[model samples]
Target: MNALRCLGLGLLALALPVHAEQLPRWEVGMGVGGVSMPDYRGSDETRNYLLPFPYVAYRLEWLKADRNGVRATLFDSDKAELNLSLGATPPVRSKNNVAREGMPDIKPMIEFGPSLDFNLWRNEADNTRLDLRLPLRAAIEARSNPRSAGWVFSPKLNIDFVGLGMPAGSKEGWNLGLVAGPMFADRRQNAYFYTVDEEYARADRPAYQARSGYAGMQFLTSLSRKFGKTWVGAYARYDNLHGAVFENSPLVKRSSYITYGFGVTWSFLQSSELVDVGDN
Candidate 1:
């Protein structure tokens, strides 16, 4: 649910990204788009959701907000930096998914914490770089109010190539990014997605307790380019749950799944001067 719900925005943010050449101090706008994605993490079902995307990202002296997630760069150097990671997940309704039929609906989950990033490799003249990122976030859910769920630690290796040559062998306009990593969650987070209680359990699904363990692995790639007032971004993601600790859960439907999306952002308003980076 967390991965699928945010995939759209994540992709769009890439599409509407701010490039180095057009480093506008700030940007503000909105757009309407759509994304087709699976119902949840382990479900085989699919649904299309229309998205009302709000555009907001501030590049400032101390903070930077973009598709990469909001952060206050407390420490920044050529190689390593530390900041906060803000992320969230959408809820899954039991009635909407077959495998979760009789179970209670899930509440929205939010994560916030810190991250340490290191520049594993950088070739600025070639416009390429590799980064290793480690982020630890506390998970929470808001049903009646915010309640702690558990925690997640995701470490990823990210590679980027900007304004570089493409498959056609031209460097006119293209930006590419690739990232992969494993996700780990505590027992509470696992229970939130895999546990089954006696009251709502069906004949096929018995009451069971879940334990803390590995969640899954994810790989994502994105490609983008800008054309005048419009920008296009395309992305694909894969999640492997075959080796996941909760694979035995009755509510778990598929062992693997793919989520992809395409989006476009139009820029009608922009600034050239160094404007104050507003709150995003």
Candidate 2:
């Protein structure tokens, strides 16, 4: 369950920097990685995952796809870009979780919406760039009995470095990325994971209601580089929920935690067609 979410985050973490270069219009491959993270946002229980993931990249004029995920470019300019974005979270088995012990299982969720990204700064000489990304998405359960889970709005500042300070070869430059942001979610989304109904509340866990507002803050850093036909990457993310609206929920066992993982992929096939695009 967590594998899909972990794979999505891993791909985003390994996103390539922005630069003008010629690359295959499409590339396909596969890889596996190990991840360690909390069962849920604030849960004390953790799960370690070793999962296989597909690697695909398709760069079309209006549709772009890469490690950062697929995007339908609605608008593009020298300093700003508007596109479709996505997000996901793993489900939780209540019976297996200490905090959620007699409650119903939490379903997996998927979010999709538009994102507006601004290029704050770019130094071609130094191969560095800074960007601000604002994404607003609506969530829905992924299972057959799907239901709305409210919405989320997350805005982050991202910085990327390419070639300037990396150990990779000149042809295959390394990229370093850093992102930090605070998240906000609606009441329904919060309640889906934090609310403890009276019927299911226990002595140690009283009935609680979750509110809409500050979800938390996160800081993530990643490093990656392609070696010939193989690409390798790693990332670490820090999440803090000290001031979240659901911080008081009994299910929230930790206010802060770290998620980390690494993986490598070897591209066995790529299109002969090439496109002039930013770094990949």
Candidate 3:
């Protein structure tokens, strides 16, 4: 279901200012949980799914991979770095959506690309830093007639804190992150989800073509912590499509919405080696 997309975005949220701390070399296990989310970006109808997912990660000197995606460090330094980025979006089924009554069903999308980040500032005392991030992705349809769909770009500012920005947090506590940015899409990508052809138009829904332009703005937050053998994380995302180029499309039903989810996992397989602490 849409859980794959949720899982993708959840992994993206894991990206932070690479901290100078030893991390487990690997954590191999699985997580059992469920995801509840809207059928599409702005749809009011929601779907819930229950499934098990692998939670595998290998931390290396210049590479990292986990449930979120993979990162191959191409350039690494104290001030800046460039790396590959990957994520995904869930499918949209017209049959189950009111607004998309007679339209074609959209499949899950696989997004992969690159990201460049610059460290804007840092508070060494609290291990907190602010960074400017730019990521561009090419979306590929991943179900029911797969093909290349479109591209997405997001440039945002991020603030990350270790141990909840508290001096005592070093002992035990929470970590937090915040990112705010605007979303943009190319014509082909925008049209894939919002376009309506004349033949499929009805009295209540007229034919319309989607254009390439601003898609929306999003504000997202993540709070997570590790306790004993268990790790827990939570996230919330808010999207406002007030002035989106496709807002007038017949398939669009709302101008704004919020999505939230949480996941917990217990590691049964783990690496004994501690990662080399450095900024990358």
Candidate 4:
């Protein structure tokens, strides 16, 4: 499960935002970080991690592998873009969790689908940008004979600040991002995490079927900076499952929690050729 978490974090760390400037079209690096998070969204179990992640970035006209996650552009404009996005979820072992003891383990899952991003506002003088993002993805378990988990929809408002609160003549390029959103999922997706089978039910845990509507709400903040060949960054996310459809499920041990991590990366390779990312 930690390996799966590392993979997801690696993908995320590669998308660090940069100030508008000419930059290499590609970069490769490695990063080490520590993280503290729950076993799953609603699980009470907390785990700390010290892991290494590879960093990769690529910029292209129709395909961009940058701060927005890996994407294949289907439609593009100055104010809006429609693209395919990818995401992942770490697995949970039943044996390691008290609520899931004696129950089946959950597999790591990958998600991919289309996303529509709209630039709602921008302040060129302050270098601030705001966007509304809507993404719907299909989830699939990772393993031999992978199975479909279900679909998830998340709509969020994202804001970014570049070079904010920096000292005069500071060379460091700092980016701060804030995102908040509500999540929704189908019955099958909710069931994957919340369902309890009759055979696995105990005196304290009753068999229950999960039906989905609202999953939860989340707020996240990320800060990153680039210093010469090295980059450092951290992020924290707050998840609230209060009033969620699965709140009543026996597996939901906590209603709110925070996940956070920080990392440092040294870019070992980058393209000699520069691309005009000033307006990107």
Q: Highest TM-score: which candidate?
A: 2
Question: Clashes in candidate 2: how many?
Answer: 0
Candidate 3 error regions (>4 Å): 1-4, 8-12, 15-18, 165-171
TM-score of each prediction: 0.87, 0.92, 0.91, 0.90
Question: Worst ten-residue run, lDDT, model 3?
Answer: 1-10
Model 3 misses residue 10 by how many Å?
Answer: 2.5
TM-score: the better of candidates 1 and 3: 3
Tens-digit lDDT track of model 3 for 183-278: 899999889888899989999999999999999988888777778767677777788888999999977787787777777666789889988644
- Indicate the worst ten consecutive residues by lDDT in candidate 4: 1-10
- All candidates in order of lDDT, best leading: 2, 4, 3, 1
Each model's lDDT: 0.71, 0.79, 0.74, 0.76
Pick the winner on lDDT between candidates 3 and 4. Answer: 4
For candidate 2, the lDDT comes to 0.79
* Residue lDDT tens for model 4, 1-280: 1222344343254232434566789999887777788888798898777778777779786776754466555665767778676777677788999999999998988888898878788765536778798989898999999999888898999887777677533335677888899999999999998999899999999999999799999888888877888877788888999999999999899899888887787789999988756344
Tens digits of per-residue lDDT for model 2, 110-153: 88889888889886463777889998989889988888889888
lDDT of model 3 at position 120 = 92
Cα shift from native, residue 211, model 3 (Å): 0.8
Listed per candidate, the RMSD to the true structure in angstroms reads 3.8, 2.5, 2.5, 2.8
